[model samples]
Target: MAKTVLVINSGSSSIKYQLVDLESGEGLASGLVEKIGEPSDGHYKHEFNGEKHELEEPIPDHEVGLKRVLGFFEEYGPSLKNSGIVAVGHRVVQGGSVFPKPALVTDKTIAQVKNLAVLAPLHNGPEATGAEVMRALLPDTPQVFVFDSSFFFQLPKYASTYALNKEIADQYHIRRYGAHGTSHEYVGSQVPDLIGKPAEGLKQIVLHIGNGASASAQISGKPVETSMGLTPLEGLVMGGRTGDIDPAVVFHLIRNAHMSVDELDTLFNKHSGLMGMTGHGDMREIHKMIAAGDENAKLALDVYVHRIVGYIGNYAAQMGGVDVITFTAGVGENDEIVRRMVAHKLSPFGVKLDEKKNDTRSKEPRIISEPDSKITLCIIPTNEELSIARQSATIADQGDSYGNTFTK
Candidate 1:
């Protein structure tokens, strides 16, 4: 029997999970448990053997959510008792500067993740909760952690720095630590195969646009710069999160508007971006609203694409020039309007959009750049769970790397 790796991406309100065969790199089962803590709208959607099933249940906490997950496996997995489960891997958003790569999860690792919660307030908190629950439920199984900020570990010193007092910034470890790293790493690994060249020899820009968006510039397989900084909010406009706002605006809100720090933080982190701009965060709905003559939706779409175009241009200049520009994630892979709009805005840079190709849906990579365009444009869907599972299996083979898994 083939060994299986269970990958879990614990979020504030949901968990995205998959079971992959380590040797063949094939998904055995994959699904998501969404809207936890709400009785009416919460459920687990499981997909296996080309079939999907949804079960409604009340899950009040991460522990309850995870128990429901295990219940699903008990009823659906090959064997409830012995299914050859080799390892479990988690996607941790912030590992601080300590972890440059995926590490086998340990008690120390869990504690370290907890310590870094302040860095990624929304992500690390739930991830640590999920880790603790898994430790209790699956005591014998090994768990590994893949840091979301690990890919930006390659950010050049200049791009990573902020114009702040050296002492204060150093004490706080305040520098750009990019997010959506697994997606970037997946793109970087696949670039050589897709373009038929050495990855280390290319100047590339990866636009990972989804609910959360970011742009990263890679020079010779190393990340020199990225749009997201310090937090996930420092890049291109996103669904429900504000990106790249002037610092003065915060001060004005605090002093002139009499807003508290907590209020200011929530304003930018929760109630800003496309949601704040148009009252809709889902790009598909925003696009629909625009077509239906909603001015706010139209403006949000314009601003979102404009920000992406600006980043592409800036990265092109920073890299001297860009050889290839690739788009991945939700909006990049499926949103035709976003793809065309962004490519059209970048036409002045000798990047032309192939309309027919841009409008099509393809699981395989499809280049939407005009034949004569200088910059190659393509869409490559990201697979982060597969990346985590592979990393976990490698670490599992090299036992003792994560100390001992919390032995009961």
Candidate 2:
């Protein structure tokens, strides 16, 4: 009879979901539906109570894919009909500057989010579609949108603004609205818990590296600067993104290569990054190629870690000093080599990652720095869904803004 929250992360071709009991901080069920509407095949994979279930079916659209997810809940376990779901929290990739906190989804809010699609076409459009479907299916259920960009809304103006014509920039709403905010906020807050100190005393740098990666510098539990800019593609070199590139390259590709705007978009957003450099995006595959003496993979790994290391050093200076450095997300949490390589290079900066702790495979948060290092290093696995659920529940319960976010 415990109350729960259903969290949904809608992607262009996938929906990642979880049902959790907030009080227990335990996920009751979670799964993903991939390749939805793909001409070849669609897949549904679900996990409950340590068991896995999968199915293949022609899911023609997002609605069907969503239905399949709920169906799996019924077929597997933790039937939603009796789970007492208080709210459904959706992870929206871009909320623009309009929303500084999780929003109670309404028709008006949906329209507002749709208008912001221009800033995140690959994400907002699809997310809006999924929201529409969820509304139609669960008309009476209270739904909240947890934006990935909201946590960076208060980034220092100097860090968020670009050196451009303020008039034109303001008109176009062009500013550094960093993404992966939930992860950054969650990890930053958890650092105090991991290190047994109050958050107010911590100046921490959080690395949320995955297929898409970003870095955030949080001072006194708030973001001062972050790597991702106006869009996700502007940050670290990701699995398929050309990050930190010269803007003129777009014009060059369009004029010199005779590529259209859409082609260049796909090229930079989809065909670039690790795969573009080394022909594979998954880190595990890249490691295999590296072991086989693939120079491209080796260079890719170097380039990847180099971006991360540079950001850590820059953040340390930007914050005047750093007390802790934390890693989260896919690569930061699991890739032992990545953590070690970055830490080894940062030894001069008081980042002495303990070899044994760095290699520990457990997902629990723990310090990875040497006992005598001046700066602390640890791993805090991000739970964005739970963060969203907590935010949503808090808002629904008393309309209180969790200290994690602030407005201009």
Best by TM-score: 2
Best by lDDT: 2
Candidate 2's C-alpha runs over 4 A off are 399-408
Cα lDDT over the full model 1: 0.85
lDDT tens digits, residues 73-138, model 2?
888988888888877888888988888888877777788888999999878877877878877777
lDDT of 2: 0.87
How well is each residue in 1-408 modelled by candidate 1, as lDDT tens digits? 778888898998999889887777778888898887775768789887788889877778888888878887877764425657777889999877877777767777788898899899989988988888887888888878889998898788899999999999999988899999988888877877887778776999999999999999998878988998888989899988889989999888888899998898888987899999988889999988988999999989999998998998899899999999999999999998998888888887788888999988888876788889988898999988888888787776675444543332
Off by over 4 Å in 1: 38-41, 80-83, 399-408
lDDT score, candidate 2, position 236: 91
- In Å, residue 245's CA in model 2 sits off its true spot by 1.1
